[model samples]
Target chain A: MARATGCLAVSLGTALQICLLFGTASLLSVGGGNSVVPEIQLRAVDTYHWLSAAQFGDLFAIAQAAPGPSMLLVTLVGYKAGGVVGALLATVAMILPAGVIVHVVARFWQSSSGARWHVAMERGLAPVAIGLVAASGAIIARTTEHSPAQLALTAAATLVLCATKLNPLFLVAAAGIAGWLGLV
Target chain B: MSRDRPSSDVSLGRLAATFCQIALASFGGGLSAWSRKVVVEDRGWMTDEEFLSAMTLCRVLPGANQVNLAIYVGSKLRGPRGAVAAVLGLIAVPVLIVLVLGYLYFRNGSVPATQSILRGITAVAVAMTFAMAYKTGAKALRSLPAWVLCAASFLLSAVFRVPLPVMLAIVAPVALWWAWPARPDASP
Candidate 1:
């Protein structure tokens, strides 16, 4: 772990920047991790030139395939910007603010467990959150799927996932094999 | 079945270890399901009702849902230090794994050999995002108003490229109004 981060010389300025970017993103990432993905892509890929859009997509794949949260994409983006230090900083910043908020609210949540507005808020926000989730998918699709074969594969995978209870890792693994074989 | 508060005697090591197991078990998505299984079923740290409510609260808050959940569970059982320990446990190994993968990726600089495989995997990952939307939308978009809200949000972010704050500013009020309980004290 130390050697991996040691590969790059991390600077204070870069550390600060990574912290600022991901910390703000953590709070704004209402709905879930995917909600902030487009913004992170915009900053990390377009503004900062830390990585290519394709690389961002690739990292997203790796994060998804890996264990833990898909939000680990933020770590990859940080790594591109500042190496291992950037990765750790980004992950911490991404979770800290939101983590604090949840910690504080969790206290209030216990007390307000059955409040009427609470139920209303829950029902009311569900559709909106679902929409944001779909938008994230659309954004990712735009970034990742270019070739006809890739696009078709994405569509097919989506269909399979929606129609069946089959685990997604199988789809990802099969797709990787297909790619390795140059089938897609 | 026990609706009373759980004992706070759980050690920090146990909290961390449980979450570590949950994180490792949650590869390829389904972190939430894994968390419920472990926290509510296996460990009995929280009852079904408490876990379900905490799940909703975690989602409703701003952080990554799973991370926020870890915080909630940790704090509930062991206060702030427990929260830190649980989160570290949840992410420690995974962070190392991701960093190693990332190092290999950057070092190779997109070799043609692995490019094809990554391309294939990227497609499935993208599909997973859409599948999540569909699964959630199926339950949430049963009514016309819900569909309208869902579509509006999709268009705003996906097509118009609106920032999140602005998008929520436009749609959230209307959604809350539509969803507010008709009776102030009616049974759910």
Candidate 2:
């Protein structure tokens, strides 16, 4: 077992780090959680060496499957780094600052019809966010599309989703079956 | 655009419950679809147009779109307190579940069935994202110039591998100009 430090110190330090990660990711998340995956990959796999690339990918997949935001990978990383205490610390840290900020902003927005500059800001942001989303898709495709079979699966899934009104779960199930069969 | 009177009919409790439902039911990144259903279709919390506008606003905000969305929806329904309640409920429940699951997974090195299920979900998520992009783009890309901006940004990011922030800095201003041009009457 890893050495057990004072609970308060571990909690506080882990919480602080989690807050910083969540805050920076939130502020810079123009395109959403998917857009921030590369940054998370860099920090978790490359910088800290907490997990290998494959492990990180697996964590991401699990995060997506579970629920809530895709950013929940933070919790898994924290767990790996420090255990249950770390997971709690990270979860609280990741949420608190952004929650406060949004609450404050919501209050201000409620009372005031936002100024023209605020409207202008949204207009300016929309395309940037869209571009970021596109970039995120490209990055995920690059990283995950390692084989011809995987590429075909991705392409077929994309086409099915685009062309038909079929629920997306069907595509996912088919791909999983293929993966299970070692087809991709 | 119209500054209508705020509706007093929507209850805070109902809104909070709806947000919790969204959070819990939103397995496999289902918040976007669940949001469309609850807010726009089921609850009539907001009109379809209002829901779309809120989605856009949430996307640009500095948080998970779902969390940001809870804030927007709650605030719209009641006030700041409602926003706080909604967001807290949405996050706390999910966090608890995820933490417990994480603990279990840590103890056990792998869960094969879970892994397989996620592989399936990932394939679907990718497709869903693409479809969402197309739908959103089609609605927002009203002009030829707007399409040009979308195409250019896509190519620059997808093909050239330009960093996203830099690409946005280059394309966003142009898109703004195209979408809401300066009116002759308003200009000095």
Candidate 3:
């Protein structure tokens, strides 16, 4: 009985921690979902020891492989640590604060019509967002596999993606086939 | 390709269902395009201009851009309750699906075949990011100052390994100042 109670206590505590951790992540996520990945790593892997860096990477891959938003990886993280309850807590905590901010800001923007700063802010941030997104891409490439074939493939992809209108998912599937066959 | 923009009385249920469809459809990136097709063209919830501007804002703000966008669109349509409904619809299903995938991965993570497949996919995923960079970066890579800013921002985070928020703090003010709307009567 005591051990079961202890287990419950620990899980509840960890679930709460997941909430706070993700809440902080949402607030600090300046660039986008991908931007806060390292922070998520720091918390889930480093601080909490819920999963190793490799496991975190695997979860990311799975999230990518599975259909849906990339941010759903947080659900994986939560489930790994504390099961379904943890996943629910993490997802809610991760989005609610940010959602409220968007809501409140939208309200503010609606009320403050004709605000000149709005357009200026949008114009200025557009370029910054663009650069940061590229930076994010670079970071992902660097952090993921960096074998020679992968590097060559990435280079090829860069040229092709910039030039062509082909869908990326098809390329991803092709790459998977090559990988499965030990080509890449 | 669907040409049916929803009528103006976007109920909370309709908002939820629409975002839910977007969430399910967007896989392996292209969330933005999917959102555009649905929100701007399909529902006419927002004009193209409104959609573009909101997208830029979503990217600029914190959290997931898509999720933030859902919030923005919902709030624009029907305030806080709408925002909640939209986000729930967008994520609830995806979360369950991802967790199931995670479970399978955890169970079979040691398999050689699984590892190999992941290996290939990871490489391609990296490439997609590069492609994403190029696609988005082209827009801002037009002018000299924009190029300089892009390079500086890119180098700071990608090359120099600076944290994103820190780089944002350093770059945002200068970039904004440079992009400040020019006076109408200013000399050409």
Best by DockQ: 3
What ordering of candidates by TM-score runs from best to worst?
3, 2, 1
| Model 2 Cα lDDT, one tens digit per residue, A69-101 | 666777777676556666666665655566566
Error of 2 at A155 (Å): 5.4
Q: By DockQ thresholds, what CAPRI class is model 2?
A: acceptable
The TM-scores, one per candidate, come to: 0.68, 0.69, 0.73
Model 3: residues >4 Å from true position, as ranges? A1-25, A28-65, A69-73, A80-82, A107-114, B1-62, B105-113, B119-141, B183-188
Indicate whether candidate 1 or candidate 2 has the larger TM-score. Answer: 2
Q: Candidate 2, which segments miss by more than 4 Å at Cα?
A: A1-61, A77-86, A106-135, A145-184, B1-61, B161-164, B181-188
Candidate 3 CAPRI classification by DockQ: medium
lDDT over C-alpha atoms for residue B149 of model 3? 77
The deviation in Å at residue B51 for candidate 2 is 5.7
Q: Of models 1 and 2, which has the larger DockQ? A: 1
Which lDDT tens digits does candidate 1 get at residues A1-184?
1223445678787788899999999999887788889999998877777888998998997887778988998988898888887898999999999999998888776557568777666677677776766776777678766789999998999899889878666887898899889987
TM-score of chain A of each: 0.62, 0.60, 0.66
Q: Of models 2 and 3, which has the larger TM-score?
A: 3
> Highest TM-score: which candidate?
3
CA shift of A70, model 1, Å: 6.3
lDDT of 3 by residue, B118-160 (tens): 5676666666556655655555456787788778877887789
lDDT of 2 at A39: 78
